[model samples]
Target chain A: MEPKRSKEASGGSGRPRGRVFAFPPSPQRGVALYLQVADQLRGRIDSGELAPGDQLPPEVELADGFGVSRHTVRQALRHLRDRGYLASRQGKGSTVRDRKRGLQVNPVIGSINDLVQFASETVLKPVSVVEEPAGAEVAELLDLEPERSRVVRINGLRCERDGAVFGYTKVYVPVELAKGLRAETIHSVPIYAQVERNSGIEVAGVEQRISAGGADEELVEHLGLEPHEPVLKISRLYYATGGAPVEFAESFHPPSAFEYVIHLRKGF
Target chain B: MEPKRSKEASGGSGRPRGRVFAFPPSPQRGVALYLQVADQLRGRIDSGELAPGDQLPPEVELADGFGVSRHTVRQALRHLRDRGYLASRQGKGSTVRDRKRGLQVNPVIGSINDLVQFASETVLKPVSVVEEPAGAEVAELLDLEPERSRVVRINGLRCERDGAVFGYTKVYVPVELAKGLRAETIHSVPIYAQVERNSGIEVAGVEQRISAGGADEELVEHLGLEPHEPVLKISRLYYATGGAPVEFAESFHPPSAFEYVIHLRKGF
Candidate 1:
């Protein structure tokens, strides 16, 4: 439905080579017209029909083509310019510029159990598992006595659809509890769930410490990341129903591959 | 309380010239000995007694000084090494290293109202305020008709306790509602809260989109950020009880100054 124009916008070749947008002016809708036009233009740019440095058709042609007034056409162009999508010179009209690509990864940030839930969408591959003396660090993190304590360390990689490992995880569980956790099932079940199944302890809470750090050599190779690239480092501690610390784990995620998103409710 | 040591852990020199830690070997407690020792060492480093590049007393001397076994001392040192606060050389022994400071700003990730809540702890310095015709982009974001809509734009900086601006925010509100918002009150009250106070609309929901972006010149100047530093960009849309969009705000936060944290419960 095209808005009837008083006079077809003058002085223009209406053709824009490829499929141009059909923005019929609806004066009643007033507010969304220019944005709709801009969205269409953005689409064209994204689709490569409007190449970088390609000058847009004159204002009259755009107005005539979209069946909107010249004023709306100007507004659309200005919006695009503000968004870094277009460059306008005095005599050159408007030229498309290299567009900024938005973020690629948007991970849902949630509970430790969310990892197991994500297993439904992604795949986990076990790298190694070993039983070692629970040293001072592990003992402190997991609430185990250092000198006599033992821990089972499970190393794994969480991979996406394309077989790219997005994160490298190291999970440490008490040796007493680890005996019941099968290595083969590590990929299919969440670590916390496994801990619950084996130890008969319900996970009461999880404490997560998140920070950004430069990737070390090991992560650079395991995640195929560039050396010193920024990575999201997460350390998680799991506590039992009675507040006994049960497990400690650390994971490194490349920024390009994952983003943690959280939703907040007011006054919760 | 220091644990009585067995034979004072036989070793060479007891005098290292500074106050060393008092470690009691609690075999009964089992798990946290090494961590306790590590914490003391960390404290000494932080206290400036163990200067960077200063050799930690030999492990034997440390064991004797702390009245702990050599194994426990080694465990503590290893823990410090992993945290980037200390480095161990094959023949030279452990030396203090520059520690990587964790993120300084950890903001509770919550609703748009949280921004107003934050004002209680800090201060907002207004930069600019103007009433302009709502362009297509702003209209679409705020769910207003472009031709008839006008928006009140407020640009400001959110500064921390040390008089450093950590974020830059731009808030847009429809002119009809913006009429009740006073520029003077914008610093103390969130725009949405003000809109609710004046327009009698209780906000029911908020949609937030967050991503990371490289700082542009504007952010660099306002946030005193280094060129190409990462910034967290958040776009929030506040909706009234009936889902009528009421406010559109965008904020940029320097990575150093703020980290958004959200706690998620299981099965939420």
Candidate 2:
């Protein structure tokens, strides 16, 4: 539907495309008309259609383009400015804030096939593979004993197709399972698949825990994230044929780099 | 097995219990002995047993306690400090860094029953419920037209027992289905359930999109999160039996407050 013009909005073509969304004016419901205008403009800024430091059109122009009164446009601009989407000073029209657009990686995590698909889509860069004493928590998760079991810790970065990092990964296996393991295999294949191939024991189950927290300084540097930026922390335990956890893996995902999706049927 | 301790360690009864994790000092393996000590100590600090601002035992005392050389104790201290887990200076003993223990809520999200379970476990406190003009994205998600539809927006917070805030929730329903939706009913019942009950339509499927990003200033204030704290963003669309969209809800979960877990058995 064409936006009814305020008679002057049709005169301007200099504004960057998509910056001025022109749908017919929304019917004034109980909520103020200015709030809708603010939200739509904020959506553009949020999606990066209006980049950092990009100046919003003059109030009269925005007022005309939205087919709203100049007073309403002033109110909308003030709302966005208060929300930090725009920076305004005397005589200088609002400029979009330098807020970074969020980044995310969409990974499916339902079954083993999904694991294989995820592995094929991304490459693992092994940072280190060495034997470390597993503490009580790690021992319990991987089904090892703290006193007798020293686990092989395989740490790495999972990278996207263009070499952008997807996340930092830490995988652990009992020392017995690591004796003949090659770092190359860990980098080239999904670790659980390799475990099943090596031990000839089918993986019976996968338990996943997904949580959120901030990146430490070292992790922030490695993931190229802002310091103290929050991250998605996902850890999985792979069970062998009889409920023995053969592998434990944890990944720290920078939001700009990874996300997960789940679809469920109500009848299921 | 008792920790093999040097004779000097036997004299120390003043150290706080659980602070000195006395697992039989791990068998010296490929990694450095000092590194293993660092890891174990780091684990304690990470789990908050050695709380923020807690002081580490003196070097000679720690050396005897772990049955290690004073030099090794110093090295471990230096490692912990380098990793920002310890605060060390010229003369004082090392102290655990003031790191806030990471927080999370564990939610199961693979079925509609899980939603029922989730709602039953938490309480929602409504902030506002009003008809707002649906933007294009909201319109598409809720199956409405921007020009003709104003969605009933219900905004609230899900709270845990003892009144801790769980997250911020925003739910939208098409105005047609929203007629006579009581704010009291919205607060007490899950909106999707209310839709199913009122519309006489079965919720055929639920599609969920999970992503991550830092909270805005207003959200930070509402959720009691530190400035720029990252959050788990979960949005779900509820579809009717014939695939008509009926409800769209999104929640911003603070990691310290909530987490998601999924269990997938193999051979499905």
Candidate 3:
């Protein structure tokens, strides 16, 4: 959208200047003005008209361009930043941050390992492997008929560019799936692929839940964040062919570090 | 743990005693002293001995009780607040805020209809709904085969107790999902169940992605917050029994008003 040049500067007289915003006409009623502004900017970003790392017009320029107050522009920027679309530095102006181009998956897909690989290019950092009793939530997800499922828990960090830990994941695979794979395998290969290679079972579906939280001290230390930093929490369930639960995993991500994208199309 | 009291009160000489602290034996060497104090307090809270809404002892008193400096107690309190266990009110002292209970599921489920019940519970106020083309991301989630998915977008404010507009949500459901429901249904029933009732297809599973953000003006107005308020953003997907994608949703919540929780257990 073209920034609105000052009417006084353009015409110099009382007569109106004939110019329409290249963007859609601002809605007249219902939604608040700043939100309408935010919506417009969000649409532009999603369409790639505003690319990542591109600096936004100054607040004054945006306000003038949109025929709104500087406060309104700031409001829109604040919303975008919180949603991971933009970042602002103290001296530098606000720059577009990538909010798209991350993971997209059907929750009920093959294995947690498959989902992770499909979600992003993965770099794994092994933490530990241990055995423990299935918790209430884990048992429910695995469909274990009392005392039937035992899991080998693998804790690790998944990273993208520069080894920045986008997610800290803990995967619990039934003991049967862990056969032949020692703790050393966790560092060498993706667990889901290993399970398939050894057991000859393909994963087909998955389930997942996502929520928000603040990092505790341990998480902050691992994520290299200051205290009180917010993070994303996700839990996923993976199933093999015919719907047998095979893996359950939970992961956390620093808010500014990642984006989860989904493509919705018109259909039944 | 009992407070380690000094056995002799400096012999009651009335002169200033040497600055020697009487503290319990330290557990592990090399651990930060303040961290140890913080852990003890955290344990009390986790164990339910320090219940939510209970006021913490004054920093001076706590420091004296632990035989440490007031700065140490402040550091611990700050850590607890950062973890969401306690919140400080100026002049009123710090009170436990039940971090676990504060976490909740983001209400933007699959369909706009599903949102109605959540709106009522979370006190959602509608802003508007508009028909729009499916963006690339939204298109993929609905399984639209290349430029196929058309969607109806709904926007609104979600409030918490005390009339604060805690967050904003934008829901996009396939146009078909909007067929049987009117805008009024949003105030009366959840849209997900409504979709199931109309289509005879039960919603079997859901997927969600959550992250933290800051509030914009419209979000602030709706959430009754100031500019730059931190919030949570969530994206969700809904599915049917045959593994068909049904709905896609995104919602946001302020940090002061909402928290997300998951019950986790060890699997064996």
Candidate 4:
């Protein structure tokens, strides 16, 4: 069956609406004029009314339908563009972008061996290494006194060969344990391996907490993501053989850039 | 050291601006007025100009300061509210909320036994069950024909004893293998166990992909979340003992309500 056009779009006629017309945009109402237009447009895109590659109505027509100025339409377009929803060219009108478009990096990380293998596959670019006081959360995770304890915070961006950063990891080490570590050495090796080699202490186990969040300014700058883009936040607390929390790490991954894979098996 | 205010906020006086006055909201210049206001407000919150529990300036004061209408201020407040940054009380004004609000659940799932134990700890509330044609992503993951393959989809909300929903899972079973599974049976038993019992086949392993996203309309409704809240998205492909993908599952978790934990141990 053909898609049904709204009464306003059909103008009380049974005929299908033109490509350039769909919802009869209402006056500003209490909502911001541009937000009203943007929300409607987003709804259309989400509902498949306006599909990928589909050109939105010209600014003048949209202004006329929405009973707003061309500036309002432009603002709505700009908002969509900033949010990775629309693409505009010099002469061509704005087109709906495939919102799900991006690079797909699937890394299998289940066992410690898998984690080691994944670290080997990626190039670690150390950005900064500094000693700082641990915050309450970090201190709790690392089992240190919040205000009294200092930790060496190592910031690194993990990437593939092309230099496109998929995620940024912040590794926190107790100052006492970071005596001989250097930022330069971290670039060539994973922190786990470096920790083991430098300290002669084995990492017996690790506890990780995985969650989701929107990109903040730092993430935007590092990952080159649009504002409010989704990111995977993984926090890990590495423990020594006797269950002492040694290293606490927080890593953020852009949704499209990385796919974290875990293999789960059933037991007897 | 005292925080330095931006030049605009300082108004050339060189003194940090008071909380009541910060960024001067510009007109809708190519950007959505609410977005501009929201971005500035978020910046102030992030910069600690406005601390948690601090009430925002009255709408009239905000309108006068921002050069926008009260409606625009309300829209900006709504945006922040939906993003979990602001809380509006009935009689009192809008207050800056603790951005890091909510419970943290960290369940460590290391071996198959751990997963089984985790499932046993949580009760599953089946929401709905239906048979439908597979979508592109589901089909691709399940190794089935998109649009042609049929599958049984079961929606469930995992809750604790207090009835707080921590996460929701969508379990998809290929029609051929979903013979005797019913919604009632799913309420008491985990899907993996049910699949094995019903089909007389063992699940060899599950390949899981974890990502992050903002809560959509469906998630908002089911999870009782504010709009645009962050959620953890986990996709699992269950392979039968023979290695054929049989079940495709997607789970969405509110960050405050759930924490997926994985423990990795070093090998010789």
Give the C-alpha lDDT of model 3: 0.62
Residue-level error in angstroms, candidate 3, position A35: 39
Instruction: Please identify model 3 stretches exceeding 4 Å from their true place.
Output: A1-101, A105-120, A145-149, A182-188, B1-124, B127-210, B213-232, B235-250, B253-268
Please give each candidate's TM-score: 0.51, 0.58, 0.41, 0.58
The 10 consecutive residues of candidate 2 chain A with the worst lDDT sum are A98-107
Ranked by lDDT, top first: 4, 2, 1, 3
lDDT agreement with native, every candidate: 0.68, 0.70, 0.62, 0.72
DockQ of each: 0.05, 0.24, 0.05, 0.25
How well does candidate 3 match the true structure in TM-score terms? Answer: 0.41
Candidate 1 displacement at residue B195 in angstroms: 2.2
What TM-score does candidate 4 reach? Answer: 0.58
> Which of candidates 1 and 3 reaches a greater lDDT?
1
Decoy 2 TM-score against native: 0.58
**Candidate 3 local lDDT, A1-268, one digit each (tens):** 5545444422211121222322364353545666777887887887789888688887877877776767767877876664557766555688786564345432221123335554445666777787766766777878764455577788887775356577788888777777876666565466766776778877654555665666667677677766656666677666776778778888777777765543221111
Candidate 2 chain B lowest-lDDT run of ten: B100-109
Task: Give one digit per residue, the lDDT tens place, for model 1 in A151-242.
Answer: 99988898875788889988999988776888777776777788888889887656565555556787877888776666666677777744
DockQ of 3: 0.05
